[model samples]
Target: MSGHACGSLRHACAALAVLASIGAGTAAAQQISPAETLLFETEHLARVRVPATLVYAFRKESNVEPGFKDEVRLELAKVNGKLNATLHFLTGVHKQDIPALEEAHGNPVLLGFLEHDIAEMKRLTGGSTAYFRKRIRMALAEGAQVSLQPITYQGKTVQAQAVRIQPYLNDPMHARFEKYLRKTYTFILSEQVPGSLYQLHSSLGKPETVRTGTQPADAPVIDETLTLISVTPKQP
Candidate 1:
């Protein structure tokens, strides 16, 4: 893997850790419903093939153009009742690897960055209702606004849920290290297509330069969008 890939992976891991820590305090407050369990089980065990394209746009500053465009082809399939996904980065910077199949007890719909294990997979896939519930609670506690609205993606419309988290740091001891951050996540899903994720859009207030000490002195806001290009459901 190139240095950029390594750095991106590391940053993702760190963000996951921070999210986990934030939810740790409210873990006991969460309730799992039978409906959620059934949905999770059905989705994880479903025989289907999902082929999607992930487009990543990197902008250093507002005035400057995007630094580069990266495209990755993601293939998700269930083989012998095991769920697995293969991510092929067409850019040729990173080697193609097939992550091991594991029980999707946490995140049924694969949405986030592809990882090897279930825990990491859950962290990477951020569209889980349970995960968003935790974030909603935290945002509400912090006096942030949450909303739900209908949104369109790739000519398909779906209801999108979002939460805006203000600039707040949790750990007082590490306040200095933590930069003022504002984040907004929009999750798009179709009720007609259960056990699947349609799209996810995330916006960050701070710039990429602040997180990664690279060039482009000014803070450039970062935006990411993940969409499902097509799905082929297998008949039982």
Candidate 2:
């Protein structure tokens, strides 16, 4: 761990699940749905051979504050014939090991972005990440609506699965965090993409008005997106 990692990063990282190989599955024994399979059980990184580098574009828009932009870089390699990942988390020297194949094999873009958002939510609302993570996990397994949708990747259209969930809409803290009661998170994934995860869109209180591409007066406080830009392969 680095100096910057000793702070909030260490606390929020608990959201990233590192499971046992007992089945490389969840602790509960039950039938898994397509949404759970796509989000967790699928080997998203195996579609690409190591060594590789995945770059993602990160952007945040808010009605109350300045917009922010950055890029997340992930380096991929092979360790003991399994996909090993080293992520330059969001900023600073906070790097960590992500055994993409052995545990939580979902792409870092999905896990890391959500982890970052959950951390921010904690900072702003004083809520526990475990509460949010459980709601999301349960939503994927029990409440998510999965469907195939066409998305553009690298300037071409490809078939992707979109998993949409609203983890906090009916949250017990409804009266506490009233502003974000309408928060929603959407994930797009495809086998064609190297890491399988294409994009994650999250918005709170965004509403549709007329067809002129205008937001209502009560637009969301925060609108954020993390999308895969490209993947480059290197000599292993």
lDDT of candidate model 1 versus the reference: 0.38
Q: State the weakest 10-residue window (summed lDDT) of model 2.
A: 1-10
Query: Which residue pairs collide in model 2, if any?
Result: none
RMSD of each: 10.7, 7.4
TM-score of every model?
A: 0.49, 0.78
Q: lDDT by residue for model 2 over 55-128, one digit each (tens)? A: 88888877656767887887888777666676765564323333343322546666677777777787778877
C-alpha positional error of residue 190 in candidate 1 after TM-score superposition, expressed in Å: 2.7
Give the alpha carbon lDDT tens digit for every residue of 57-156 in model 1: 2122222234234444545555566545554533454333434334232232232432211232134343343443444334434444445657675565
